[model samples]
Target: MNQQQSLFDVEETIRNSKSQKASEILTPSTRKILQLLTSQRINKVVTASLLDLAGASHEIVQYIVGPIVTQQNGWQQSIPSWVGKAIAVDRLDTALKEIDKGEVGKLASSSEVVALMMPIAFEVPLSSEWTDVYLWASYDALLRHRPFENFKYDKLWEKIGTTPIQYEKIRSDYETLAADIRSRIVKHAAKEGWGKRSSNKNKHPVKATTTESNIQMEQLSLFS
Candidate 1:
């Protein structure tokens, strides 16, 4: 069949991945198969049962028809289906973490942050081009620097998964997102006054009565 036919269900797969938190919730086998199914080099020829194993039991179509993502006007090529699923999951999870206000303590359940988080947890749309445009803008800004001209999102994510820096600035530059996350987490925790500090229950006892040495001296005097 043609490439178009193979990718017919790409949208549905992406929707399920987002709704089910496939990145965080799917069985490992399902996740692996989902990732494999997105490849351009895999010949797009998996059977329907394979997709079922990847958690798409509803799909009964036998063959992969074509590319999963429809080509957009300005895009040089079709964005990979897995890319949207994974990124949407990331954005949703991050927003949820922020709304939980560092951790789920009593504060989290009733805090302003939860109210804040409940609204934005899944607010980011998978088709939102804002992030992609930002990444492209970031690459453009860094292009003047050596080794950064080769910046690409896949390379950036790959390096983030590895030791980061080898031949490009992708590692250091990409990790700014991690730093931002940490900063936000700290901010949330601080907002609720929720970090480690000496509690009154754990404080040192005050010097009560007299010292052991003083007590011994008093006993000796009495004996004397």
Candidate 2:
């Protein structure tokens, strides 16, 4: 009798947990931000960062979104400061040297430049310290529509010559990267104990806050 009662208690607890989750509500600010993501009005992974920052002080949101918002509104800017943010700086330098030696002859387009860069960029493990620095530098360059932003392009031009790729192609590539980075962010959140996995194998658990769960649902509705 006691054993049967214990199993019933466990089932009851799980039911209550599921009920709580199903009843979660979205705050107004979170709902607005999620609408932006769902409608594809703001299509970068930075929108996920904004979802993370929502419900914090207004100043924090402004500080985080100011430059991106400005760029969205037709103000062109380059993040020149991302020049040397790589952990494996030597790796990139060596790749440049190899290119100079004609290891790959005439990188005719930005996609080829990215092909050369991909291996060197990911040589460091994504779980290793400072990995996000490298990832963000890569993501930001694409976000700013400057695929060659991290390279010493003047020096590169002198070596492999000018490699121009279409803006539409770059945008398509950015969409793929954004999807990848969104997955990484969720896994990282789980590692940090801010998220819990659901019973559904396909769904990733998000942080158990009103805003976070709402954001997660919005992402899932659009993506999954």
Candidate 3:
């Protein structure tokens, strides 16, 4: 097929995937954040203000974006071992610090930081089965980052050899894993009474904000 034909065929295939109910829940800022996340290089820092523009919470953004970016950029898997342990250690240390600093409000604007520290939270231990699944899904998504690829159902099932009857099982397993980790982390933070103090620090001053906004506006206008 010609290049144009190939592109069109790919687009058509993507459109045929099982559709979720359309929800108007995502704000414009959230949509923008998703877009930014979808385009980022793995391990790259996406700044707080950019997240503010995207309207995504830190937890949600980290949950969704971290795996994809890391996978695409090539990183370690989530299996329990020294590597996982090391990751867990790092997470713990960071969480403790963030909580002590009362930087909870910054969570919404700091997905990369959260992603790095989540596995260490008391509730979300790195060795837990749930953490494995969460890391696995994120890694898988990253590994298969092509716009037209369907990792959720297709490739994932193929890996586990339970594509048909086990599709639900696979999804359930992963969801359980992710949820467990998230719960643990939150609980740990709460138990430690972290995030009581707030930092009034501003990374971007008013002058920089205005300049960046103007640049973003120009880019938007071009697209429009």
Candidate 4:
């Protein structure tokens, strides 16, 4: 199926998933934020900040609703900062390159810019609880308002003058690099024992107290 259709199917599946109630879709504010991000006329920085705001607001929801939801169904929630960092870095790089080539003015709209940013930004949280929630939320948003096809591949190449093969390779490498970074973070967390610390401590005997107690016991024995 086409990208839009696939996204729609994913959304339907998430809506019907056993882990989430059918009514628990994206919040209206979240939808509005995403809509702004997908709008062609919005500034890129504004879009990014909206995304950041959405993330921050979600933290509150996760804190309040997270425990009950997880207890009922063993769900978890995480923000996956590494993924965000990677995407943000990638977008900055792309923007810089486009600016350097004097091609920034050629873009049709911000929606096109976000489309170009998808492969980098399409990341889920590291923990399973957070991952599931993020995936469901993202899938819901994409289904309601698909933005993948807005990327003008032709215009992008025209601006950057890169061949399709080169672009594909770059995209593939970017994905691989991000995956590697995530894997390393996971491994490090595991090796560190999930941030838990050992609770054992050794105590030394008080030599002066021990000697005084022995002398008192000897005096008591002589009196007996």
Candidate 5:
């Protein structure tokens, strides 16, 4: 049937696209935890918590893991829920406010300050619309480690607060990442389509190659 073939086509396209992102897999330890999830050696939910905790620094891990492994209560229960909240985050200013409040507070308070998250050094020189797009896309790049949906060239650099010396030192990489990001974003959009979802009132689909997705990613970039 036509629907069956369409599904196969999408599967093939996604498989190929996933291959292109071979560099984006989780770290070895994280991967091992994922394996445990699949193997059922540990509870799937617990494994997710462990993997999420893997993102923390070694000292933090040491402090937390001991209690998690030893405690009889639901110490690990809150972790996966927390990670779920993190990956679903949707605003940058929320992150700023969260950090400003301190990570020792609530679930939203003790948030990860994503690396490569640069301070707003200079005013973004683009138009208001484009400026918003560029910032969101740039943050999405760091959040997802997927370059697609990001700004290109100088727009990319400016959003990340790339210092002058660092920019010059790695200018070539910046250009390369920008190109790849744009291409990926376009390809992702084309593959996902430009339709809107019925469940939401927004004009954009939850995940599409159009401005709606950009808006969503932009919002998420700020939060995550």
Candidate 6:
């Protein structure tokens, strides 16, 4: 085939794959994870890593075409705008830490001060630029910075590099969205008979506390 013909064929294949419902092929949790991972615009974008995190085995990976994501080399060039915002947030976080330590001299650089101030001056597109998948990733990223339950408002504000009002609004929105996602994942897991699996080693009754812990562990595994 000619180069143009090949390109057209690839596009057509991708479109066909996307037309099919993702639920028909993969579970809700798997589809969500795959979308979140693929939407990440970062260096060393590994297709296999995305698949692995989504719990797709090699055999299942073969059947995943463009529905979950387009397996292409363009992600590196199309870095998400939010990722740049995140870098600025990180810088501000360091500056704030220095300030708290009474190390005012650490932030003496005018350019550094300006760079740090930029995030506060400009509004972050916390709920605007981000899609649901991106929101999921953002929530996970914040969890890495600090667990949500243990997060202090000022700490989160500095970590996000946003004004108090803006931080409050966005933080609430993120929590709401994250809760919804978790609910859906739990429902999907129950739908897939995850709760009803029997232990072959257990001919005896499983303790109630142990079962509850196992359930919690399974939910954690889906995210981990």
- With a 3 Å backbone cut-off (N, CA, C), the pairs that clash in candidate 6 are none
How high a TM-score does candidate 3 get? 0.31
Tell how far residue 156 is off in model 5, in angstroms. 1.5
Q: How much lDDT does each candidate structure score?
A: 0.29, 0.30, 0.31, 0.28, 0.29, 0.31
Candidate 4 overall lDDT versus native: 0.28
Q: Candidate 2 lDDT, tens digit per residue, 142-185? A: 44344354666445323433344334545544445443433433
RMSD of 3: 16.4
Q: In model 5, where is the ten-residue run with the lowest total lDDT?
A: 208-217
Tens digits of lDDT, candidate 5, 1-224: 33234323333343344333222223343343333332222222232223222222222112211111111122323222222223223112232233334331122111222211222213224454333333443444344433336536445556467432333443444444343333332333334332112221242211211111111112112212
Per-residue C-alpha lDDT of model 6 across residues 1-224, encoded as one tens digit per residue: 43234323333333355444322323344333333333332111122222222233222222111111111232322333334333323323332343235332111121222222223224333335233323334443454344246567446545655433333434554454444433443354344333221421132221211111110011121122
lDDT of 5 at 117: 22
Model 4 segments more than 4 A misplaced: 1-25, 34-154, 166-172, 183-224
Per-residue error for 164 in candidate 1, Å, reads 6.5
RMSD per candidate (Å) reads 27.3, 19.9, 16.4, 26.3, 19.4, 21.1
Worst 10 residues of 6 by lDDT: 210-219
lDDT (Cα, 0-100) at 90 in candidate 4? 35
Compute each candidate's TM-score over C-alphas: 0.20, 0.25, 0.31, 0.22, 0.20, 0.23
lDDT of each residue in 111-168, candidate 1, tens digit only: 1111122123234342323333234323332332223355574565354343323323
Q: What is the lDDT of residue 33 in candidate 1?
A: 39
- lDDT by residue for model 3 over 1-224, one digit each (tens)? 33234323323332343142112223333333323332321121222222222232344223221221111111113322322222222332333344335353222111222233233333334554444444454444334332335545446545644322322434665544335444444444334332222220143211211211111100001001
How would the candidate models be sorted by lDDT, starting from the highest?
A: 3, 6, 2, 1, 5, 4
- Distance (Å) between predicted and true CA of 34, model 5? 2.7
Q: Stretches of candidate 6 above 4 Å error?
A: 1-161, 164-168, 197-224
Clash list (residue pairs), candidate 2: none
